[model samples]
Target: MMRQFTNQQDLVHAGISYYTTCCLNLKSLYDNRIELKTMFISKEWEDNMWSKNEAGRRFYNLVVSNEFWDGVLYAINSFEPVVDVLRRMGCGRSSMGNIYGELANVKREIAFRFENKEEHYLPVWYHIDCIKDEHMKTPLHLAGYYLNPLFYYQNGNEIEKTEIFRDALLECAHKMYPDQSVQERIVHQLKLYRTASQSFGRARATLMNFDPVSWWELHGSTAKELSTMALRILRLTCGSLAYEQSWIEMVHKKKPSLVQCNKFEESTFVMVNRRIQEKAQMKDRSCTCIPSQ
Candidate 1:
């Protein structure tokens, strides 16, 4: 029998976060599919279902079978890691520094999950690997990871141990600087940053929000060159979620029927600017209202 599911329209319109959450919840259900299948195949359920219609009984039988349940579980497991990365990337404030490492972890996890069943998972692994090689495997990502204090400090030893990572980071610097002398200066600044970062006890604190851009702004004066590099890297958004959000808002503000054909672009620009101003004002007001300890 078909069951009515509520809020499907809302879920579809809600954006990436909501959709990912729904997928995560569905994954949990798929994890328990075996038990659910047993319940569906029970004598009472079989009697109730069969009493309804021939088609319903046949469908129920197919769903409760081992082959169908296995396929469902496999699909869920295969897509879970991808959904996780997408969820993070689709956030407003996702860290660019974390994307490279996160994708690598996803690749490793997928491999581990399908180690013995290579024939079944090889396609999935190959696709994910191709994405990693094409987009994620870049000097910019390596440099971002190296300069981000959170990853650099936490995964320093691991990063340093990896020859490819070291080479990529240096390669990024060389390309960016171009001049040998400037490259040497950049390297020196990176060393200085490492020293200063190590001595900053506050970096280890968990309560403080770790914003790489803000961190560089506050403490990066000592290593001027590296701070510039850090700021540039940190400013890069991990995904297009913010732009998508703005476009959605603009579309809502200028509904298709009501939008002027000639003035559409102008209207969208005005709407986006207004929204940005509103957000800025709200932030300023909140900051002013906070009482000092």
Candidate 2:
């Protein structure tokens, strides 16, 4: 029946998002919503044997319900920000420097999308906050955000006055370079960076480079120690697995028994491994069978 409106083969299939395909499924269903409603109400459906049955009538009721469609719309809007963050992390590259900023942006995006309605965005924010508070917001992440030239240069001296940034830098400095002398030197270099002095003040440094680690490499020679710190912090992984695991744990909290938790973990593991194997097999086949010139 659905194929009559649009070929099922042409609709979105399972390879769009990482691990879970819920977002892709939601997107596909939402895209075909009008077609679905029209099909349910068409004379063809009325003449069908199943349409007169109790189960079919109930299914039809759901398809035409305003409340059901409203809920789907709300889910799409709420889930999109989280999915975007996941997509950014899954880009097969280092995203340590951007995760903190990205999470902040997620909250802001959700709020803005719902026109600042607390009731609408609060539940989503609460779950995100739980993940962030427990796994993210470490001194390392904060240091990365502070050192990344992408964010640092935008806020300018304003970040210098921010206690959280100052504290995070100090914490990372002490942790990474325990020696008092080295810590003092890092602090001194931080001042130079803040004031845009030395190598940091070079005309070349003023150019807008989006890669934070690369920016430090190119323009941070004068403060070699701070540059090294930036490279280490910025090169770290944002841990896409951590986000996925945290979400799973959050769901487990709402359910009962270790059996359910184990089942969920097993299913997720199988799904991800299957996809990985499929990609690997495809790569091998392509390598073995060269295209004709």
Candidate 3:
């Protein structure tokens, strides 16, 4: 009996599982193509199968085509970067500060792969550019990068310190601290932070567990105004997966089959708050477990 293929959704769900299965399936086909060809072309099988089935002959032709394998490799290479980023972003501990840099690196890798032959990646490049224009490369993202001490200290020289980025950081500071006098204080504190951070060496033992919010809370006393701004920006959520997860879990738990729309919204709001508190507690626990260097 043959199983009927309905749609793409029936083939794979739209998540990490889908990408994992796709990679596995492509690898299997590429690896077993020789064995499959031998079976298909063998005298007994050919007599019984190829002679009786048009689909089998068509598939054998496809298997022998160089273009088919090229397309498979191209798809795997293109989707691998996207899948890596998606896995990282879906983690519970993922931070907004890290996403912008990672996305930039992925774009660079994709460009490098198709260098000098831009036509090969024109479609992919367009999608990457669209993501940058729509979401990843915004002012808020720059602020996240600016406030992350680890990234700022290590990659500051690499990142283009454009006037726009500086202005965006200052604007973020103003929004967080609306008082004109406080804003001036924040500007001064930021200057002091820049000077001190340059001389401060990060310890290797604590580097992996470093949290910008906790760093500000500890060393931020010297630069209280700037620290507040850092904390605010660093705490911002970079991706929507967690929020979406919360809504999905809420729907599953509530089983709101016949509930009114207004009640559903109210329940979802409460669930979101609970989910946020749980995440905060988890973060605090993880922070405590990190040994002080």
Best lDDT among the predictions, by candidate number: 2
Tell me the spans in candidate 1 whose CA falls farther than 4 Å from its real position. 4-58, 105-127, 178-181, 193-208, 240-293
TM-score quality measure for candidate 2: 0.76
Best by TM-score: 2
Error of 2 at 184 (Å): 1.0
Model 2 worst lDDT run, 10 consecutive residues: 284-293
For residue 156, what is the lDDT in candidate 1? Answer: 74
Q: Mind sharing the TM-score for model 3?
A: 0.66
Ranking by lDDT: 2, 1, 3
Winner by lDDT between candidate 3 and candidate 1: 1
Candidate 1 C-alpha lDDT tens digits along 1-293: 22212212121212234445455555545645555565566666657745379886676777678887677667765776776666555533457676776666776677677765788677888888787777766777877777777767777788778777667767877777777886787787766655545534454463157577787777776667667766877788776344346565657575777767657777667766765564444443323221221
Clash-forming residue pairs, model 3: none
List, residue by residue over 1-293, the lDDT tens digit for candidate 2: 77886555344445323433566567667778888899899998999988999999998999899899889878877887777666545543446778877777789888988899999999999998998878776898888878877677777677777788889889998889889998888988998888788788782355574477777888888898888888988898763555445544554565546546568778668766764465444444323221221
Cα RMSD (angstroms) for every candidate in the order listed:
8.7, 7.3, 8.2
Question: Comparing candidate 1 with candidate 2, which one achieves the higher TM-score?
Answer: 2
For model 3, the stretches where C-alpha displacement exceeds 4 angstroms are 1-24, 27-51, 112-123, 154-160, 193-221, 240-293
**Number of colliding residue pairs in each model:** 0, 0, 0
